[model samples]
Target: MTSTVGVSGAGTQDYDVIVVGARCAGAPAALLLARLGHRVLLVDRATFPSDTISTHLIHPPGLAALERWGLLDRVVGTGCPAIDIYAFDLGPFVLAGSPAGEGFDVSYAPRRTVLDKILVDAAAESGAEVREGFTVEEILVDGGTVTGIRGHDKDGGTTIDRARIVVGADGLHSTVAKATAATSYAEKPKINAYYYTYWAGLPMYGQFEAFDRED
Candidate 1:
């Protein structure tokens, strides 16, 4: 039987949307949702301004999205240099050009530590609850549909964050994805690998370079 809902369970409905992984993708989504007046909960296993292994460059399209979300200035303000040129070194040939057209005349390669915090801060400014260093332990499911998440905090305290919808913005090895039994169709094996490290006082600050080598 369908019963009338009341505010008594409002406390249990912790949020309208609970977003896991407060990085680039998840943070922006939470920010937009919060700006639309929805109660959003953004959680991440790591703290903000933390470094993660990934490409730092945000292309023109991504830059446009940040601009639309009113965060471009904040990201650029972090002292990340603007990239207006691209160079590709193919084994036998080299290709280069300014791909950013009109609205997007440049790109930014801010460190994840800088970029993520800007997004998380924006999400908080938009009214989304932000929590860091919280690890999701389980995805709560009711009968079949996902309802919330069970996570543990830094102090080993467990908490259940219930929401009307749950989003997994976690990276490739997302725990939420595993809990939800999501399918994967990786058609090709990883053909290459790259590593990143800190560098200082070198040239080429505002340019994109892609070098292709035959191994």
Candidate 2:
């Protein structure tokens, strides 16, 4: 029960994999898939140059992905150096690794508006058709497999698209999840007491003393 409202005589005519969310996870996934030569459709409820605030930290594993896509060059080309981790709790703290031994490696920070635009454009250039102001209303399923989805285009009205493999890149509040009930585990909630903010121009060492999530 997953599909898209194929924009009729409008933006991005069609696609093979229609990703619902275009930020964070969805955007990157679409770009990679498109590079592999799939007709990818990238959609987002919000338009680019949009503001998204959070603890925007991508350490280690994400760097590996960037390396795979060869975007590490471009991201690093933006001038943010890799973050050096230093854990601090009781005192000057423990450096995650020896001065020249073990530790995680990753770049510091980049604004969402700046970074996401790069990813968005990369996906589009990779051949994924990216669009904004499109919202998915339901997942179209013909049987057991995810088929396609239906949503509204920016200009208005419902659009329907059928794909062989529909990816539910739409996170958390994903319409695909509710439509198919794909998960086996029950969801849980946690009480968080952290306020996230961005600190540009300041040297950001990974694992600062402020972040204590060992609860």
Candidate 3:
């Protein structure tokens, strides 16, 4: 069972690390940290089995990491097919090849709904306290140092949690990053847009296809 905390009438709780965002990056960090016997608090605004916009492809290196973490079998059990070949259509001709590496031969494209929940569950099983549906409203700063976080549960019950380290694993527009005025380097403007959708009865046949068009 996953361990959760309620903010109703709760006082300030302390932890060794507080991670915001419980998806791919945050969950695994929490899992490994908790496995090292540190008190970790992992919070995310959305609950598990939720969908997010993504390319949804896990390359071989990622699969190998999951294998090391002992979660690859569970992902395969979800019936997500393996992707071995990649084909690119460049208008006049096509380029096709399989991934070439020693231990990196295949990849998997699982839906975010399935992938995120598995990661969160693994973190929880590793003894990281997971708070789903919890929104972090503030990053507490004390004398130019981040000391804690102030957030609320889904029911609007507020709570304050302190930790030695605060991690901002929340995506592109991370609240923690904004709070800390983090700087960005080597960033580029968007040049293209992508549209993705799921088909009910489509099969990929262990291949990934990409098309190039001059715009």
Candidate 4:
């Protein structure tokens, strides 16, 4: 399925990039490309402000990227705390939050929903044509290279975006990666024997039980 919308360009002929997925990686990539003056089509399966399960830990690199994109203010304003590091010799830690690197904020911690929304907005602000509520159906190709993508969207109905570069930021199970024959997931990777969980929104407590999904 392909969505037909009022695509504004040099007569809807093509785009510089087509990014599948619009979360952390895809969204940032799309925004960066758009900021570089590339006509980008950013698609994702979820709408803005979607709920998700995550620790919302942003690495220093990601924080730098946000600042580079000039969206640092949004992040700070979203109540996402600035955390310097969590040096846990063993107990639930404290906010050792500090600015100790390159005069840049070396801290991060926010709800995944808030952080994700921030990135999604940044992608749009990067001049990327953002389309949410869309599922990537397939990666269009030619001569063993990426050409575009086809998918079904919520508002635009169906979508067939053509671009010179098609980036797969769709996460672990990536269709673009699969169709392009670029990468594969390995089942033999080391797995953690221990597990953990958090009683979010619950009082900052002193005691809690332990469990895992398989338990």
Candidate 5:
């Protein structure tokens, strides 16, 4: 059943689900839940078309998921090149092959600015109430159960929204996870650093390459 908003003593709004973070993970979840006829509220601290550090590689399986969601074509329409070949450089020898599975033969590496906006838009289109630049400050708990969120918008207007379920898709060090004292098992510390840059005239010829160095 669809959620209904009811006024409470705290002036709180209501929804079936409240999704914190509206990027890759949360947006899709919000869209799917809204599509299933549930009232969904998707909130993000940043605005759309924002960039973030990410691998940016969408493999065949990921592409298949987007295909099932009918978003593959939208991503393809962004003019991002398709990657059909994979090459690994081990300094001594190289191994090269194509990634194949689930009837998908190609992958993509779209910029997060573009890809994330598309996802957020999809969630909004699917009837999710999207709140960009909304920072979730607190997760409400009643009887040891997560009930909602207290946050604000860019203008610093505080708002409290209640939900049947609260989702923490805010990535590492999520506020919801911390509020609930969620434990992480088998977690490893950072072993390496990553740096990324864009090139204008370089060509890959549909190849995705990874290099290993001893430095």
Candidate 6:
């Protein structure tokens, strides 16, 4: 059975679902739940138009999902160009082709700042309560089952939200995963270091290029 808890005289506030990390995964899940008429609370530690370290590339299948969710137009409306060509250089060989799939013939590399905000907006518009800059400090658990989350808002105010279901969509180093002991393969170490920044007027915008560098 699902349980709920109240915080700070909020009059027993409760939701059907509570989602942490309002990015690609969390926002979409929350949007779906809200569209299904479930009360949802979507929280994120970052504000809109803020950057996150991401490759931001969405393949045809991902584009198809976005289209099904009615968000592809919004993504393209942000002026993010679509990439149809792919090139891979393996030093001794080269492979170039365009990916074709149902309802999508290309891929996209929208900026993270723009993409994430669009997802969050869609979740909000679908009736999910979204809280930006809300940091999840703890995952509430009982009898070995996840219940909800305790966190802080942007104003540094503490908040304890409860729901029937709690989803941790936080990225790789997820707090919920750690608190629930749900992680594996901890022995793997970082392999490479990557540094990237956006630049304007790059002619390679609509082209996907990959290089194999051994140095």
Q: Per-residue lDDT for 75-142 in model 6, tens only?
A: 99988888988999989998999977877778989988889889999999999999998998988776
Report the number of backbone clashes for model 2. Answer: 12
| Cα lDDT for residue 59, candidate 5 | 89
| Candidate 3, lDDT over the whole model | 0.85
- lDDT, model 4, position 122: 85
- For candidate 2, write residues 47-164 as lDDT tens digits: 9967675435666666677677777677777766565654545444543541222233444466677667778888888999887888888777664555677889878889887676
| Candidate 1 lDDT tens digits, 1-215 | 01111111233577888888888888888899999999999999899779989768888888888889988888888877889889899979989887575489788898888988898999999999999999999888776667788999898999998888788888877776777677666457888989788788888656788998886
For candidate 3, give the lDDT of residue 111: 96
lDDT of 3 by residue, 1-215 (tens): 11222122223449888999888888998999999999999999999889987549898878888998899999999999989998999999999988655398988899999999999999999999999999999988777777789999999999998887888888877888888787776678999898888887886699989999997
lDDT-best of 2 and 5: 5
Lowest-lDDT window of 10 residues in candidate 2? 1-10
Relative to the unseen true structure, what is the C-alpha lDDT of residue 49 in candidate 1, on a scale of 0 to 100? Answer: 76
Best by lDDT: 5
User: Which 10 consecutive residues of model 3 have the lowest summed lDDT?
Assistant: 1-10
Task: Give the poorly placed runs of model 5, Cα more than 4 Å off.
Answer: 1-13
**Clash pairs of candidate 4?**
2-158, 2-159, 3-158, 3-159
| TM-score, predicted candidate 1 vs. hidden true structure | 0.90
Best candidate, TM-score: 5
lDDT measured at residue 194 in model 3 versus the true structure, 0 to 100: 89
Off by over 4 Å in 1: 1-12, 185-188
lDDT of 4 by residue, 111-184 (tens): 66788898898888769999889988877766655667788977657767787667777766678767866634
TM-score of 5: 0.92
> Between which residue pairs do clashes occur in model 1?
none
lDDT score, candidate 2: 0.68
Q: Write model 5 residue lDDT over 1-215, tens digit each, in one string.
A: 01212222332448888888888988999999999999999999999999998759998888998988889999999999999999999999999999898998888999999999999999999999999999999888777777788999999999988987788888876888788777676677997888999888886699999898886
- Candidates in order, TM-scores: namely 0.90, 0.76, 0.91, 0.75, 0.92, 0.88
